[model samples]
Target: MTEQSAVLARPPLPDDGDLDLLLLIRHFELALLDLFGQGLLAGTTHTCLGQEYVPVSLRPLLGADDFVFSNHRGHGHYLARFEDPAGLLAEIMGREGAVCRGVGGSQHVYRDRYMSTGVQGESLPVATGVALHLKHTSPGALACAFIGDGTWGEGAVYEALNIASLWRLPLLVVVENNGIAQSTPTACQMAGTVAARAEAFGARHHRVGTTDIGVIRDELAPLVSEVRLENRPLVVEFATHRLGPHSKGDDTRPHDAVREAEAHDWYRRYAQSDADRFARADEIQRDRMAAIVREVSARPLSRWEPCG
Candidate 1:
């Protein structure tokens, strides 16, 4: 077996409850920032600093065999499923020890069942296709596509939605509406609401605030369960935000707006003390991650080999 495949064969993910998962996500993002700043991770990384709750909330509702299709800002989604921060950091740093053999970087990360694509709206169709396959072979399995509000303008997204709804496929389309798509705000990009479009497609849809994890879990657990059991399509629009700029070197918003956005972050509204706890936990995880990086960096790169 190839080295990448061997790494993929690591034991199954542990049963990480919601609280521990949240801490891990926060720490993972901080480690990414440190790596980016220290020049260890080459290329730009889209950090989901404030929006960590979206994926963390969704992780519990999903099964191990279920698939996740991620968009550009998908480090959280990848880590949520794989739970391999050291391997992910190595991937971003282009080390041979990375999960993808050091070729995918931050924009593209792929393992056996999880995938993150760099192109906007591209994963929508890919997820639709996967859902179709599951409908025929593994009726109990579900496929989820994570897209941003900016991708709403893409024709492929609507097409995928229509197709999934028509086929009654077990699909969950998650639109992470962070208000701003890159530097452009949602108001300037799309006219109608994402809910309206899903309605027109005859797909079940839900819109929820990102502040409360309980609210998210309460709303999604049944919907996800319904999709897997009934083989239907569901769309969940999470009202979240990008805590940082669109990506590294992409901060262009006014100072006042930035402050307002940060002030209104969902995590802040959820629990004031929790924020402090997260910060403290992040410091500890960052130190642990640094040690992991050092160890991974010491290993030789996985040799490249042709796939069968």
Candidate 2:
């Protein structure tokens, strides 16, 4: 099949959906790491590589009037809205030219009036506050928080859940439960299902597989509808996995090498099967990666800027 024909055959972009944007963001994140070597280098990076479709499918449920709060694993969340690739690249590179003024690097990037990165679960409270503020002024505005399964262990998460539920704030909390929290499996660490925990706190809940973007799209649409209509909070747990090491500096030596090989093989198969997206995304990523690499490499040593 021809190149465009292959992509056209793979998966049609959802009507009124923005999933492809996340695909572009994933490529951008990977390119930044591989080409620019500018982000979380030598340190573990919580990559949102395989989990691209979840945010893409879910983002349509959010309007510009809404707010998004992201976690350490939030590259998808930020790029879905702002489209500020250069600013993110600069922040990751620790250049004084960064969006956070170099104060926030890979995990700490943020921009006002759009989205916030850099702090874990920090968005939850901020989102909660936004919801509360909207309650006072424009109760129609909604706040969405994208957090990880690992962050479920944080006291802040539970506190936010309690506060949000108590007030019935128009909040949407999504947990990207990627099976593993760092090296520890979800079964070993997560106290219980995220949905169950949220339900116990009197928050409405839904759980869906992240692998199927369609399923997530269906799961979130109605919930967002309810939040818009009722001004309530909903907790959605997306069941997925991290296809790579936790971060850049991770030592996967103790993990199963066979599993790693299998994942890589699976990725290869998927890429090859989807002839159109693979070809297009590959070319786009390659070109972008190359440019970023050249830009970073050309920077003089004396010109290096650090985030505050």
Residue range 133-229, candidate 2, lDDT tens digits: 8777776778888888878877888888899989889998988877777777778887767878988889898877424456567767877889877
- Residue range 141-175, candidate 1, lDDT tens digits: 99999999999999999899899989899999988
Candidate 1 CA-lDDT value: 0.79
The best candidate by TM-score is 1
Local distance difference test values of all predictions, in order: 0.79, 0.67
Clashes of each: 1, 11
List the lowest-lDDT window of 10 residues for candidate 1: 6-15
User: Candidate 1 deviates by what RMSD?
Assistant: 9.0
Q: Model 1 compared with the native: what TM-score?
A: 0.87
